[model samples]
Target: MTTYTAINLIARPTGGPIGPDLFEVVQKELPSVGEGQFLVKQNHMSLDPAMFGWMSPDTESYIPPVELGDVMRSSGIGEVVDSKHPDFQVGDRVMGMMGWTEYRLTNGVGLNKVTAPLPDEAILSVFALPGLTATQGLYSIGKPKKGETLVVSGAAGSVGSIVGQLAKADGLTVIGVVGSDEKADWIINELGFDGAVNYKSENLAEQLAELTPRGIDVYFENTGGPIQHHVFERMNAHGRIAVCGLIADYPKQTPDLAPNWIPIIKKRLTIQGFTMPDHFGEIPALLEKLTPYVMQGKIKHRAHVLNGLESAMTGLNLFFTGQNKGKLIVKI
Candidate 1:
């Protein structure tokens, strides 16, 4: 093929569902593979809650927003079909930020060759962004100790599920807060969580209280909705909270106010917010800490994949609706 398809950010989100109106599909002529560069045939790409921040106009975010008329930013696993670089060879599997396109041609600067004999879905769901984010937040911020009770919001999601499993393997009593009974069942029965509280059910406070009778020693915040207050109220003295993603507040022009801080002082809690980009330099160490858990059959994940690159236009709405079961990916 002489031409390839690409999607560009045409407009920013405005507090509603994501649709094709925000993007423009175009065909571009294939570029020449220059010296010291390679061409990748992107096969699958990741869809993440972080994309909402990337699509926003906010200038002071952890990473720069995607520029209008530019290919939307994303990471994917692809094959080096043609290469002029010595390090990367033809048929070498690679993963990196290749954007919203079927083909990417560039120097081997950000891209890393994939050597693990795992499927694309497993790679993206675990070793890529999801597992890395979970490890960073859970270890660096949560500071969980064995025998302590832990609670994680969005417990069925890609990152949260990994966090819960890792904490469980470390001997912590893990409770997951999910949006549905099915998700709750999966986390508890399949993923080996100690307990689960469906946030959509009535008497949320009571449910959380019963599940976490020992008080929450570690709280991994993924979706900050009404559950945040309940978990905060149950935080034990010197409890640690790791704030990852506030998915519930992403689509709203105004978010709900947080609980009073008087308890923060009374409990002497440690709360911190983190983004993965800042610690990209420490990936080798993070992976070193996470690989053992995976090799030991401790880390479990599920992928909710969408077909075709264009499906990404609407696939993101599943996150806000809480319909996606696990890591969202696009099978290009």
Candidate 2:
């Protein structure tokens, strides 16, 4: 019998920092691969801000919560080590919702074969969910036009960084809202963003006003908090906002009150909230649109990797703390 390690959600979080107590690492024996199933050795697992929402008891979310005693749900990239499935071969490298485990047995339902020439980390970073989210949200919801002013919150992050770069490729003036001056510099100097505002600065609103003299035409919203209000007040008439995430409120039991909608009405803005799960069918097409940018060095990416599966619990907090520079992943 083959044995492997897995991380299980032992308890649901009660609206605060997630600690090691909430999870248990256990060794479990793998069941024999059934008729259509294959076995994969998970190489890299992604830790994302969305995990907090999945840990909550909220069933109304885009996806269901991870039930107690179940393997914590996560997206991972792995190579097929054994297979009885027709669609998958033994040596195929695949990516899918394989959870936080060293090994996974799947029937090949949602699994995607990885064929990109990039590294496993890059596959999980730019070509995976983050890249797809940025592409879909920017084009489908934000409706970016040439020469428009586009600003993205969490701009140094996986999704936000891609959004900024993609907007730049489309000839839009890109501005990034980040947590620190260092991150601001990375986006402005390295990622080719025209300007950046550090939300932690005392002059946040003033900085945004200066960077975006034309007013914000498209806002790729990631962390919704006071920074959201500052951007809201500077939006151009008929501006578009793609609400990608709310990392600011993820740890709170009760989120802050909704921002005033008066500006939304007065500005005649178009604001749409999206989750990547609903757009999975569009990935191939989105990748087709994004591959050139990445291959051509126009879209840059980075991954902050933790060494083992156990680090995932503590690493998730990096999203809220702004400690992670880009995509956060756990390498097993």
Candidate 3:
């Protein structure tokens, strides 16, 4: 093919709802692969909460903002259709930060070749950023212990779901806080979580208290909202918190109100915020650790797959609306 399609960030969002107008889908002539580069036909692209942070004018973040007119930054899995590099062969399946393009030309720098015995959706859901983030934050930051009570906010999401499952595997009591009863049921009944709290329920605090009677020893904070406040107040002394993502505050112009800090002091909480970029080097080790769980079905995942690259603009809104039940992916 002479040309391929790509989505480009055209403007910065103003803390309001995102729309297709901020992005432009354009067709461009395919570029030739350099002597050390290869061409990939991107099959699937991931839509994540971090995209909102990348779309904003916040260069002070862990990574730079997506520059205007650039292909909207994303991670994708694809097949190498053409190659001039010895490290990668034609027909090799790989994953990397390939952005929102139908085809990617790369020098094999950041790419990791994947041989998946599982479906593409599962690989993208559990073996990609979501799984790595969950593994790192929970084991590295949360420092989970056997029989400790653990609570996860945004518990139905890609990262949170994996966090709950991993914690459960380690013999910790797992409670997942989600937006709806259906999600609650999925986490508890399907994912084997000990308890699930619907954050939208009128008696959320009471429900959380009932589910975590032992007091939470590890809190995996994914969405910073009232659910976090409820969990924070119930933390045990010396409790650990892995602050992964604040999806609730991502699209807002003003920051959400801070949760009570008295508990942080009284409980001697250890809170740490992390981004996947800083931990990229650890992915190989993480994948080695996580792959066995996935193969054994000790870790499970779901994907809300959208049909085309253009769907990414709307798919991202699902993260904020709590509409997506699992990992969000755009199938190209």
In the range 27-46, model 2's lDDT, one tens digit per residue, is 99987888889999999999
Q: What stretches of model 3 exceed 4 Å from their correct place?
A: none
Shift in Å, residue 183, candidate 3:
0.6
Task: Give Cα distance to truth, residue 14, candidate 2, Å.
Answer: 1.4
* Model 1: residues with Cα > 4 Å off, grouped in runs: none
**Per-residue error at 203 for model 3, in Å?**
1.2
Candidate 3 similarity to native, TM-score: 0.98
Give the lDDT of residue 10 in candidate 1.
92
Each model's TM-score, in the order given? 0.99, 0.98, 0.98
Per residue, candidate 3 scores C-alpha lDDT tens digits across 68-177 of 99999999899999999999999999998999999999999888999887677888899999999999999899999999999999999999999999989989999998
Quote the positional error of residue 290 for candidate 1 in Å. 0.6
Which portions of model 2 show Cα errors greater than 4 Å? none
lDDT of 1 at 267: 100
